[model samples]
Target: MAGPTAAPTRREPTPDEFVAMQQSPEFQELRSTFRGFTFPVMIVAFIWYVVYVLLATFLPETMARPFLGLNVGLWLGLAQFLTTFLITWIYVRWANANIEPRAAHIRQEMEG
Candidate 1:
């Protein structure tokens, strides 16, 4: 009876090959779209969060002033919740538009 055949050798990719994969146009395009959406959104979200903190810290009198019978701080705090939902919605929409198609394209290219 013949023994089981030896398993084929599987070669790991080299560092240069990994770097080449990263620097490929398809990968670069994916990185560009992901970063473009994330960085801007993150910067804006951080700025918004900082502003909320500063207002709650240094601007007590103004934040305590009434708007629609609720203090401005309360309304602004509520606005933070709204902002979170809004940002999530925007990110999903942006990902669908700018990232998903490119990712799917790259996946198809890889698999095919």
Candidate 2:
């Protein structure tokens, strides 16, 4: 009969292990920075969109504006699209500059 293979040895973590493995301050800063930047923008955008919809639905005259032959509804929709793209761009830049590195560090700490 073949002998059983030895189990892999696992070293106990030292107190310094936690210090080495703690989340980076940059990670928290990035999180709070994004939260501060995005929360208000998201709230304002939501309010603006809701008000636009309400106005368009309740007051036709208010929404009756011409833009390159398109009416207000179409124009507002286009504006919303543009706004979405802009927000996406901002988020991507934030992620690349701050979030990605922080996330990588977190993942490394978890894995280690």
Candidate 3:
């Protein structure tokens, strides 16, 4: 009926619409908090990696030993995985505490 109902035309989001979606106080604070958490983590991870390289290069004697049949490098490599898991855990906690409330507020704002 109605010539196949002519699919509804979708409008592109304007800058104002984009700003309204992302510029709410709750969303702005959420973005800032996440950036704050992530930037420090990135810096720490970079420093840790640099330190690891330095140890492997200049302190091979110290890192050359085996721990539990795995070489020091292997152990240190596993530590990186552990660190990633820890970061994920921290992010989950942060999301629950800091991100979720803001998200709920945004949803209410958008819906209401």
Candidate 4:
């Protein structure tokens, strides 16, 4: 009869190891790719939101224009929801295609 098995111990990476990992080309590329996508998207999304708010606040007349029984402001507000879903979908697709594989490889390398 076998005794109870011990759990495998996880080795923690040292700070130096973490620093080296951060300095690695693969890690650098991953960071660059992530920033490249996120920064622009964030900027554009912020600009879009600001534009919407400014229009609603300063140009109420324009926003009050009606179409199909809905005000333009209502449509723009709903568009924010649509934009959120669209950005989420786009980011998921982009991450699956670009970010995930590299991150998985890095994780495997770190684990091993």
* Index of the highest-TM-score prediction: 4
lDDT, residue 20, candidate 1? 77
Number of the candidate with higher lDDT, 1 or 4: 4
Worst 10 residues of 2 by lDDT: 18-27
Question: Candidate 1: misplaced stretches above 4 Å?
Answer: 1-20
lDDT of 2 by residue, 1-112 (tens): 9999998654565667656554557556766877987899899889878987897899888578776898888888789889888888988997788778877776665545
Predicted structure 4: clash tally: 0
Per-residue alpha-carbon lDDT of candidate 4 for residues 1-112, written as tens digits (9 for 90 to 100): 9999998776677788888999999999999999999999989999999999999999999999997799999999999999988999999999999999999888777766
TM-score (C-alpha, index-matched) for candidate 3: 0.70
Q: How does each model score on TM-score?
A: 0.76, 0.67, 0.70, 0.89
Q: Which candidate model has the greater TM-score, 2 or 3?
A: 3
lDDT of 3 at 89: 95
lDDT, residue 56, candidate 3: 89
What's the C-alpha lDDT at position 5 in model 3? 69
Clashes of each: 0, 0, 0, 0
lDDT of each: 0.86, 0.77, 0.82, 0.93
Query: Which candidate leads in lDDT?
Result: 4
Residue 111 accuracy (lDDT) in model 3: 51
Candidate 4, residue 13: lDDT? 72
Off by over 4 Å in 4: 1-10
What range of 10 consecutive residues in model 3 has the weakest lDDT sum? Answer: 1-10
